[model samples]
Target: MLDYALLAALAAVLRTGSFDRAAQQLHVTPSAVSQRVKLLEERLGTVLVVRGQPCTATPAGLRLCQHVEQVSLLESELRDSLPALAPAAAPATLRIAVNADSLATWFVGAMAAAPGCLFDLVIDDQDHSAEWLRKGEVLAAVTASAAPVGGCSSHALGSLRYIATASPDYLRRHFPGGVTAQALAAAPCLTFNRKDRLQANWLQAVLGTVPSPPTHWMPSTHAFVDAALAGLGWGMNPEHLVAGHLRAGRLVELMPGRPFDVPLHWQQSRIASATLAALTRAVLQAGRAALRPAAAA
Candidate 1:
């Protein structure tokens, strides 16, 4: 039989990333938290946490943490059904991975619609967010792939449209004649990070080949548009984010009428819990309102 108290201690330590923080959150002494973690590790005969400034969980520990979180969600559901059960001391935290672009654009609306749970968001590239789910690190993800991760259900969230934009001055200076392949090779572009492929993908789609352009690695989604407006570099900016700039001539499309639409999906574990179902409904509704139809994309 599992001692839920020991498991809770381990979960709290991992979630807070420190024994001291865990102790504060659990309303226990730091020494007690440390003792609980050590006892649980001894029982499991494995090193669950690697002690450091900010402790990290081992693979086995990660699995246990995930289990604890899922159990919490199940218990929360049960409490709702059984009024006799005492309410939890704190709201459950649901960890999810989402692309920065979606977070800057429409994901918050989905999050806001789902109440009664705190959220721990992991921002990653849309193309890679699903990896968090596959690793059991996140309960749900906003991903570019339509294929469902194993044990998870996928929902079509529609496409987020991107426009390849730059300041008018930068375009004139970089592509004097037009947006030609040769000129693109000489242009400087904005990349979100090493994992970012939006600019490259846009290049390939419009030019039929990718260019090794000089890059300015700006990681923020909003900063990408700011950099473009300042002529730091041309980049793929979200349509909704840059629509006003485009209309005001503060930004111009590199290729007029050629918008890049990246289709996004919401994937979550197929647990028969009301919490997940409620979140999924809110996500679908928000996606419908904010994104272009999946079929249209």
Candidate 2:
């Protein structure tokens, strides 16, 4: 039989990132939390958490955490249907992976639409977000993958449009000749991170070849627009973010009339649960409303 109390202790430590914080949440002594975690680890015969300044879960630990969360959500649903079974429990948290661009633009509206639940957001590139679901780390993800991850349902969320944006001054300085592949090679561009392929994808779409451009790694989605406006570097800015600036001539496209659109999808576990269903509904509604239709984009 599983000792849910010990499992709860483990989940609490992983979520709160420390025994003391877990103790506070569970209203138990810190030592009691530690003991429970240790007992659970011994029972499982594997190290679950990597203890550090802020604790992190191992792969096995992450799967367990996901299980705990799913069970909690299921129990919450049960209580909702059977009032007599209801007990006072903290609002269940839904851990999901979403791209930073979506979060800055439209994901929050979906989050707000889903009530009675807390959120633990894992920000990653849309192309890679579905990996979280595959790894059993997240209950749902907003991803660029059209194919569903194993045991997950996939829904189309339309396309997020991106424009290769630069300040007029930067464009004048870097692309005086034109947006040729050779010129693009010498120009400095903003990159979200190593995983970011928006700039490269845009380059390929326009130039038909990827060039080794000098890059400025700016991870924040908003910062990408800010850097483009400040003449720091050109980047593939989300069209929604820089549309006003585009109209005002503060930011200009590397090539006018050519925009890149990434198709996005929502993927979630196939497990039968009302919370997941509610979240999926909100996500589809918000995403469809915010993103451009792929054909139109």
Candidate 3:
């Protein structure tokens, strides 16, 4: 049998990001929670969690946590097969990582359609969200790369196309003579975060060089669009998100028919569970509907 208590303690610490919070959740003293994790580490003869303001798991810790989560999900499924043993109030929750653009656009429909299962959604850049899969922090992720991580599978979900867009007022003020290299160099640009390269990519494609423009780093996808709309800076807005704005003349495209397409893939643990299968189905359906169709993947 697995060391359930030790594993639970470690998981709680990772989830809550502090031993004290984990203790409260686990209904143990803070010292007790810390001791349990220490004992597990000693027995395993490896460093697990790196203690800090927000506790983070090391690679060894990540593997253990992933194993525990997978086992829990499988066990939940087994319980479901036995109606007498299944707890009605305890539906298994899927922890997933997704890009901010997808979350802001098409992903919510999938969540809404999945009625029974709960979700813990972690938003990361599309390019980096797969790291969460490799680390086992999430059961599934919407990622940019199609290369499957070990112990995981990837499915091409389609592509989210982004257009360089700005408010009409901002465009009038910033680019009076259409998009020029000099105009772009002087214009303030909006970025989702440091990890976001869509803005830079668009700039490079347009100007033949990526200029270091004044940047407003807004991390949220919806907020990034809102910031652009509020005339803060030009940004690459996902087509689905800016469609309404474009139709209403609220936003104008700087580059028409030259959208920057970032193909997306659904990556998930190579585990058999009804919940995961269902989530994959819903996401695939919703993504196909929202984004441009790609070659079968």
lDDT of 1 at 160: 96
Report the CA-based lDDT of candidate 2 relative to the real structure.
0.91
* List of clashing residue pairs for candidate 1: none
lDDT of 3: 0.87
Model 3 weakest 10-residue run by lDDT:
83-92
What does the lDDT read for residue 200 in candidate 3?
90
- For residues 1-297, write the lDDT of model 1, one tens digit per residue: 588888899999998999999999999999999999999999999999999978999999988888888888888888889979999877777889999999999989999999988888999998999999999989999999989999999999999999999999999999999989999998999999999998898889888999899999999999999999999999999998999999999999999999999999999988787888889899999987999998843
List residue ranges in candidate 2 displaced over 4 A: none
Pairs that collide in candidate 3 are none
Q: Give the TM-scores of the predictions, in the order they appear.
A: 0.96, 0.97, 0.88
RMSD of 3: 2.6
Candidate 1 has a TM-score of 0.96
Which candidate would rank higher by TM-score, 2 or 3?
2
Q: Model 1: residues >4 Å from true position, as ranges?
A: none
What's the candidate order when arranged by decreasing TM-score?
2, 1, 3
lDDT of 2 by residue, 67-176 (tens): 89888888888888898985746878899999999999999999999898889999999989988889988999999998999999899899999889999999999998
Which pairs of residues clash in candidate 2, taking residues 3 or more apart in a chain or in different chains? none
Per-residue lDDT of candidate 3, residues 1-297 (tens digit): 879899989988987889999999878999999899999999999989999999998888978877777777777888778968846434666889999889888999998876677787888999999999887788999999999989888989899989888999999999999888888889999988889999898878767899888899888888878988999999998888898999999999986777888899999887888889888999999998998887553
Better of 1 and 3 by lDDT: 1
